[model samples]
Target: MSTRPRRPRPPHPLRDRRSPWWRSAALAGALSVAVTAVSAPPAQAQLDDATRRITEAVSADRLRVHLQAFDEIATDHDGNRAAGTSGYRASVDHMVGALREAGYEPRLQTFRVPYFEVVAPATVATVADDGARTRLPSREVAAVEHSVSGEVTGRLQAVDTDGSPGDSTSGCETGDFEGFAPGSVALVQQGECSSGRKAANAEAAGASAVLVFGSGEWRHDRPARGSLEEPGAVTVPVIGLSYQAGVELLDAEEVSVTAETVSELRETYNVIADTGTGDPANTIVVGAHLDSVPEGAGINDNGSGSAAVLVIAEALADTEVENTVRFAWWGAEEIGLLGSDHYVSDLAGNDPAGLEDTAMYLNFDMMGSPNYGRFVYDGDGSGFGDHDSYDAPVGSGAIEEAFHEYFDSVGLASGETGFDGESDYVAFIEAGIPSGGLYTGDDHTMTGRDARRFDGRAGEPYDPCFHRACDDITNIEFQGLEEMSDAAAAVVLRYATSGDGVDLAPPVTGPGGDGPLMALLGVLAVGTVGLATLLMVRRRRRGPAG
Candidate 1:
C-alpha cells in the first residue's frame, strides 16, 4: 500500500485501528524484580558511561534545535504543525531523516488520515419569545468538528429525553427528531451514541444545525465541545454546548448559529526505526507523537516529549544493548491516538507474534509543559481506580518503577497520572503490551501542591497555550526538558541493556554484537585472566610495603 502509486517507500502492512488512568505515589518499591534471575548488570562504570554518552548527546541544546526545527516547519506552513498538512509531513521527514543520519534505517508507515479543522469561530445566540437575544462566548459554544459551513436561524427544538443516563440521548436516534420543524435547530443531549450519528440524523430530518449537551458527567472534559466519530462523513452545522447552555436554549423559541469545519481525507505517516541489532524476542518500543494540534507550534504539547525521545534515539545509535530499541514518531495524535493505534493494529494483524516480543511500550507525551509537573503513568492500576482503569499489562508497573527510580536518583519529586487512554500508549496497553510513560501536564490546571512539589506556576494550565498559537519554541521549560530527557535516557538504556523483568538472551557486548558475543566474551575472558595475573604480581611486590 505504501509502494504502489508512491513507489516512494516499502509497502507497510496495513490493518485497522486498535483501541484501549491513575495518580500519585512515590519512587518506592513500585516494581518487583528478581535480582537472582537476572544476569550480572553492567558495572557502575559501564552503566554511567552508557547513560552519560546518550544524555550528553541528547542535551537541551539538541532539544532546542529540534524545537526550532518544528517551529520553523510550522512557520513555513500556516503557523501550525497539524497532521495531514505540509507542516506535519515536514515533521515526519525531519524525524526520519535524523534517524537515518544516525545510522538507523527508518520506515515510513503511511496511512490515510481523516481530519477536521475549525477555520472560523462559530456563533450560538439564543432568541427568546420576547425577542431578547443572549450570546454565548465562543468558549461556551463549541463547533462540532467536521461540520459543514452554514449560518442558520430558527426555533430551537429540544430532542426528547428518556431512559437512564438522566440527561436524555436526545438526538441519538432519528425518531427523537419527531415533530421537529424543517428549519429548527435540534438540541441533542450527550449520551449512548456518538455525536456524528446525532448530527447525521438531524441533517436527514432537515434540521439546520445541531447542539449536543453534556449528560451531567462532570468529567466530560470541555462539556462545551465535542467531535463527531466520523468527521469526514458529517455534513451539517453542529455544535457541542455545556449542559447549562443547552438548558438555556431549551426555553428559546429561536436560535441563530454559524459553524464552519474544514475537513478532508489527507494521507499521513508514522516514522519507525529500530536499533537493528538486539533481541527480536525482546524489544522496547519507545515513542512520542510528532504532530501538534492545529492551533499552534506544539512545542510543549509534544515537542518537549518528541524532541526528548528524538535526541535520545539518535544518541542511542552509538550505545550498546541487548534488546531491540524501536523508536517511533507518531502523527495525528491531537485528533486521536491514530498513528500509534494504526501501528499497533497493523502489527497485531500482520505480525501477531511481534506483539509478544515487545517487552514494553514507553510513552512520552508532554515533557515540558510550561507550568510542568513531573508526572508518570500509573502502570499498576494503583491510581485513578476502575472508572479510569487502563488495564495495563503485567509488569507495566515495573516500567513505571524504572522511571520512578530515575527521577528519585535525580532528586526530582514525581506524581502519577492515570493511564486513561489519553495518549499514544492506549493501543499497546490494550493489546496486552506492558505500557508506561511520562507527561508534565497539558491544559489541566496545576494545583498549589503540584506547584510546590514541581516548582511551577499554579492556578494555570501546565501549558497555558497547550493547543494555541502561543505554543511555539517559547512554550518550553528547559529545566524540565533536561531532567526528563535524562530520565528518559536512563530508563531506555536500562531496559535496553538488561531486560529487567523480561526474558532475553545474555547481554551483548555492544549495539550490534549479538552474533559474535560469545567470541567477544571468550576473548575478554582470556584477556581478563592474563591482566589479573600481571596486576596481582605487580601489586604483591608493592603491596607488602604498605
Candidate 2:
C-alpha cells in the first residue's frame, strides 16, 4: 500500500506462456466489472463455491483460538517462541497436535541453523583530535550477528560514504578500500550488499574492525542490527551503529570498539503435512513461518499467518480437490529463511521430478497488523520491478490477478508489495516456482495512499510491535485479519481445485499425454518430415545434373 516507486529492473528471464488458468482474455473479462454473481464457466463456479465455503468456515474466531494458544505457549516458556528455544518446540508440538486433530499425519523435517546472541552490551566510542573521548549511547550500538568477541582501537576511516539518503556503496567493493590505511576501523553504510561482504572487505584491507551504520529510510534513532551472513566470515569484530551515532564518528580521527557474543548452530524442525485427496504430481505448498524473533511472543508477527493456514487446512480437510495441498510451517525464518530454503534445496537435489511437479507455492506472513493494509505480492512485477537478482517465474502474474479478482468480487480494495525476498516465499520464487501470497503489513510506514485505502493511521509503521516484546495477541487487528485470511483461503482453494493460469504439464509416465516426453516426440516427428522433404528436393536436382 506504500505506493513507493520502484526502480526499473532487468527483464525477467522466464518466458511468458499462457495457462488455462487466468489467460489474458479471461482475466480482462473477469476484472472488467464486479463478479458478485459466479461466472458461467464451470471452473469459475467451482472456484467461487470453494472460496465461499472455506472463507465461511475459517473465521477470525478460529484464528484467535490458535493465536491464544501460541501466546500461552510463549508465556509458559521465556516469553518468546524463537527457534532453538523451548518455546518454539512447544509451538511446533501444538501445531502437530492440531494437524492430527484435523486428520493429517504431519511430519517434522529436521535441519540445523546458525544461531547468534549478544552476551553483553557492545561499546563504541569516538576520540576527537583534542584527545577527548565520547562514548556513543549503548542503545545506538549493537554487535552485528556472528561478530567475533574482541576489542580494537584505531583511526576511524569512512569508506566511500557520502551521507546521502538512499545512495551509498560503502565497503561493498574492494576498490572502496583502495586508499584505506592499515589497522583503521572501517566505517561503512548499510546498503547495496550484504553486511558480510563489507566486513570481509574490511578485514582483507587490514582493518582491525568494522562499524556498519543505518542509512536511507531505516530508523536512525536505534542501532541497525544485521547479520554478517555466516559464522567466521571475518576474523575482526563487526558492530552496527545507528545513523546518528555513525554521523558523530564521520569527523572523528580515532575510535574504539568492544563486543561480546555467542555464535553456534541450533537444531530445528519444519512441520509438513499433505492432504491426500488430490493428485500428487501437482502439489500446492501453502506455508508460513512458525518461528518468531528472540524478542517476543510474536503473536501478530507470525501467529496470525500460522493460525490462518491451520484453520484453512482444517476447513478444507474433507473437501475433494484435483491438486494436492502441502501445508508447511517453516522454522528459523527470523535469522534467515533456513527452513524453506532447506526444503526446496533438498527436493531439487533428492527429488528433482517432484520439484518439477510442484505447481506453485503460497506464503502468508504477518496478516494482522494493527494498521493493516491489504497487500498482495507483486507477481506481475508491475508495482515493484522484478527482483534485483532472480526472475519471478512465469504464471505468477496470473496468480496475482486471481487475488485481485477475489478482492474486487468482495468490494475490498488492495495494493501491491514487491517481492523483496524478505519472507519464506523467497525460496520458492528463487526456485522458479509460480508463487503469490497475501500480507497485511510489517514495520514499513504506511503512505497517505495506504491510509486512504485501508483507513489506518498514515505515516506510521504497519506493525509498531514488529520484532519486539510487545507483539502479543493484543497487537492484532481482527477485522483486517478476517479480510486477509478470507482472501488467502479463497485464492489458495482456487489454485488447489484448478490449474487454470498455471503451467501444469502432467508428469512423463507414458508415450501419450502432454508432457516433456510427448513434446520431444512431436519435435522428432517434425524433424523426420523435414528430412524427407529435403531428400526429395535433392533427388529432383540430381536428374538435372545427370
Candidate 3:
C-alpha cells in the first residue's frame, strides 16, 4: 500500500496488459482439462500424513474468531490498528496473549519508523506577471509525506519539466537547476526516480520550496499523493499537485506554497515466535503484517492474513517438524515496509549466519478480498519479467510450483501476480532469501475474463473498501478466506517438514522444461508413475498438431 502515492492504480505488471480473448479462452480450456486430470488424488495426498493433518486442522471458523478479535480491538482503540497508536499496542498484546496461550514465548523486535501527519491543509496559488493572483483548489494541492513544515512565496521555475509523457528525468539532478534562483520555488514532475531525491536535489540547489506534479497518465484531477520516503530527508516544504494544476502553473511568473505538518520518528515492533522443535539452520519464516492504515480497521487488507498465520501457528505448535518455523507479525508495514526492512537489516548486520540460515520466507497479505482471485507470486518470473533490482532467489521457482500444485490438485484456477515490492516479502526477496506468497487482489479491477475464471464481478475493485474506513469485518469474503488460508497452511507445512528440491543452488535445466504449464505438470507428477502417465497423455494430445 505504501509503494507509491494514493491515486488511480499504476501500470501493474499483472493488470496493465491484456491477453487476446481467444488466447485466454484456449488457456482456460487447457487449464480445465489439466485440473480434471490431476484433481483425482488431491494435492494433500502428496504431502506427508502429519503435514496433511496440520493443514486440515486449519479451520475457517477458528480464523474468524481471530478476525473478530482484531475487529473488536480496532473498535475499542479508535477504529484502526495503525502503528504508533494505542490500537497497535493493543493488537500486539492480543497476539502475544494468543501465542502464550498456545504455549510459545513470543518476543518483540522493536524499531523506529518515520512518521508524518498533516496538521493542517496545504495551500498553493499562482501569481501573474501583472500582479494578479489565482488560488488553486485544496483538492488540487497536497503535502508530500514527510515534507518539512514551512511557507514560501517566490518566482516559479520549471526544472527540466516538459509536460510530456515518459519525460520523467525532471529535477532528478542538481544540474537541472543550473540557472535556478536561490529563493525561487522549483516545480518538478514525478517520474524515473523518487520524490525524495528530487526534493533533496532542489534543496541542495538553494530552492526555498519544491512542488512535484504527477505524470499525465495518473492523478490527473486530484493531487498526486507523493512521499519523501522518510522524515528529515529534506528541509524545504514540499507539495504535490495534479497534472492539470502543474501544467497550468508551468508558465506562471510566481507561485506560493504552504505546508503544515508534524514529522518525526516513532517506535514500533514486530512480533516473532519460533517453534523450537526443528532445525534452526534451515528455518522457514512465515509472516504477515499486523498494522493497518489510519483510515480503517483493515480486516481484509491484513487482518485476514494475520489471522491465517496465527491459526496455522497455533495448529502446528505441538506437531513435529524438520525445519524451524518462525512466525512473524510485522508492524508499520502500511507506511513503507518499515518493520520487515528493519528486521532483515538487523539480522544481516548483527547475525549474518542467521540471515543466511533463513531457508525461505512465506508471506500472506490481503488474502480475503470480496471480489477475489487466487494470485500466487510469480516467483519464476514466467508471467512478469524479472525485476532489474531484485531477481527472484534461486529456489523461488520451486516455491511457486508448490502453490500451483496445491491449487491445481484441488481443481482451483490460480493466477500469477508480480512481485512488485509492495509488501513485506520485498525485504526477504531483496535479502536473497527465497520467497513466495499469496494475495487475493486489492484496488485493481477484476477483468471480465478473470470474472469468468474466478466467478466474481467484473469492472469492480477486488476490495472496494481497500484502505478506506469501511474495511471492517463486513468487508471480508469468507470463501476467499477459507481457500487462501488452507493453501497457506499446506505450503507452510510442506517447507517446514521438508526442504527437498528447494536447494539454494542455481536452477538446473530439465527435460520437463520450464514453461509454466510444463513446470506445473512436473509438480503434479510427484511420482514416477504419475510422470509417465502425464508424458503419455501429453504426447497423445500433441500428436494431432504434430
Candidate 4:
C-alpha cells in the first residue's frame, strides 16, 4: 500500500492581510519545512540570487523593444496579418530579425496554407406567409454562388418541407427526383446528406432555387461555408440557415431565400524563430497567435502573450539553459487554429532534423486584459462535472508549478485553470507536448461567481472590446500590464536558472496536485519569512537612527 497519505493544505498566513509580503513568505517557508522535513533553506537563498539576475536581465529596454515590435505588427503601419498575407510576411521578417538580434538564430517553417476572405455577404432566408422566418449572415451563414450572377423568382414550393431528409427531401439516391414540379423553391433540412447531393437532387427535380436549414446545432461564433459541391452545369442558387431558422422557414406557407459564397484559394505564412541548434529534436517551444479580428488591433487577444514571450526570450539570451527555446508567431489563429495546425501537421513526421526534439511546448494566447480572469490550466486534471480536463505532459506540470512558486514568492493569488481550446495551446496539447500558459479573460462578461473568485469587475467582459476596434494600446492599463509582465519574467527566469530546466517533473504536480501538503507548508513558511522581512523593510522605510 502507498504510505503517502493525502496532505491537507495549511492555512494561508497572508490571508490575514495585516502581514506584509516578506513576512508571509517566511511563514509559508516555515510551514513548508515543518510538513516536508525537507531542508530547502539553501534553495530559497539560491532562488533569491537567481530572481535578482532575472530581474536585471528583463530590463525596461528589452520590454519596450518587444512592445514596439508588437505595435508594428498590430498598429503603426497597420494591416491585416492574415495568414499568407503580405502583412504576415513582413511580421515574420520582423520576428526573425528580433530573434537574431537577441543572439538567437531564427528560421522560418514554411507550409502550404489556404487563405479565405469574405468577398460577399452570405444571404439566404425565408420571406414567407407564416411568422416563422429564417436568415443567415453573408459569411458565417451558409451560402452558394454560381459562376454566373442573376436572381430567380417563382411560386414557392414545399418540396422536402417536412424538415426531414429521409422522406420529404431526396435521400442518398441522386435520381430520386421522380415527383417534383418545375419553377419551384426547394426547401431541404440539413443532415448527413452532402451539399452537392442536395443541390443535384433539387436540380433534377426541376427546382429553380434551393434553401437549406442550418446544421442541427447551436453556435456562438460566426457562421461559415459548409461542404462544397463541384460546379455543375445546372445554374441555380442555394443557401443555408440555422436549425431554428430552418424550422421556421419550413413551416412558412411561402418562402423566398438567396445565397452567395466565394470559393477561392489564398496564401499565408507561419513565422518561426529559434535560439538553439536548428535541430528540432529535444527543444522547447513557446508560441502565440499574431493576428486579430478585422475589427481591432489584437493587443490583448495575443499581443500580451507575444510580448511576454519576446521579453522572456530576450532575458534568456545570455543564459545557458540546456534546452533550446524557439518562439513562433502563428498567423490566422482567429480563423480557427489554422496556423498551428498547419505547422504541426507539417512537422509531425517529416521532422528530418529531429523536429520531434520538441520536448515541451508553451503556448501564450491572451494575457494582458485588465478585466480578465487569470487561468493556469491544469493540463492533467480529469474532465469532471461541467468542465473537460486537459492532460498536460509531466514537463508542463513542472512549468506551472514553477509559476505558482514565483507568484507565491511575490505574495500574489494565482489559481490553477483548465486547458480549453480557446488559444494556441490547443495545437501543442493535441500534439502531446505538455502544454501550459496564462490567460486573462476575453470580451466575455464575468459572472458574480467569477468576480468573487478573481476580484475583477463582474458583468463586464474580461476585455471590453475583445475583438472590436477598441482593442488598442491606449486601452491597456499600465499597472496591470506591468504586473503580468513581471509574472512572466519571474516564470521565465525560474525556468532558465533552475538546473532541473523548465520542466518540474512529477509525483510533485502543479499546485496541490496529489494533495496540497507541500504547497501549504511552503506557503505558510514562505509567508512567515516574508512577513518578517516586510517588518524589517518598514522599519527601514520609517528611517533609522538620527
On TM-score, the leading prediction is 3
**What's the lDDT for residue 77 in model 2?**
89
Which pairs of residues collide in model 1?
21-388, 21-418, 21-419, 22-383, 22-384, 22-418, 23-416
Ranking by TM-score: 3, 1, 2, 4
How many pairs of residues collide in model 4? Answer: 54
TM-scores, in order shown?
Answer: 0.73, 0.70, 0.76, 0.70
lDDT by candidate, in order shown? 0.72, 0.78, 0.79, 0.56
Candidate 1 segments whose C-alpha is farther than 4 A from its true place: 1-47, 123-142, 151-166, 180-194, 208-224, 239-258, 382-387, 445-461, 499-546
Ranking by lDDT: 3, 2, 1, 4
lDDT by residue (tens digit), candidate 1, 1-546? 000010011111110001000011111111213232222222222235566577677788989988999989999999988888889999888887888888999999998788877778888898777777778766667787677778888988888853124546678777887888887888888877788888888888988888887776663335445667665566668888877677656677888888776777788999889996778788899999999887788888788888998898888887667889999889888877899999999999999889778888999988877787777787656554365557787778667656655554344567777777778988998888888888777776777767677777778877778778998988888988888888788888878887444532222234343322333333344444433332332222221110
**Worst ten-residue run, lDDT, model 2?**
537-546
Question: What number of backbone clashes does candidate 3 have, counting pairs of residues 3 or more apart or in separate chains?
Answer: 0
lDDT per residue for candidate 3 within 1-546, as digits (tens), equals 542211211112211101121123223333443333442233344344665677677887888898999999999988999998888899999999999999899999999888777889989888777767788988989999999899898989999987775548898888899998889999999888888899999999999999988888865878877788888999999999888888888878898788899888989999999996888989999999999998989999799999999999999899778889999999999987989999999999999999989999999999889999888887777656444324778778777766765665455667777777888999899899998988888887888767776788999988889899999999999888888998898888777876442353433344444343533344364554444444433333221110
Cα deviation at 248, candidate 3, in Å, is 5.5
Candidate 2 local lDDT, 1-546, one digit each (tens) = 122232222222211212223233233332343323322333334234556689888898999999999999999988999888899999999999999999999999999987777889999988777777789999899999999889888898999996665646888899999999999999998888888898999999999999998885678778767787767778899999888888877888899899898777789999999997888888999999999998899998799999999999999889888789999999998877889999999999999988998889998999999999888777767657634423567767667666765664455567767777788888888889988888888777877767777788989988989889999999999999999998888877877887443453323333433232332343345454433332332222221110
Candidate 4 lDDT, 1-546, residue by residue in tens: 001111112212222111122343345444442333333232224246556566556554555566556556656434344565555666667677777888877666665544444345546555545555554444445554331123555555554446542323332355554566677777665556665567667777787876656555554233313544334433676665555555555555455554444344456666676655332344677788876665556666666676667777776777666556677878778766777877877777676344456767777777777775545656445321135545665667556655555555453455555665666777677777777666666666766655655567888876776777777665565445555566666665444433434444553334534333443444544566543443433233221111
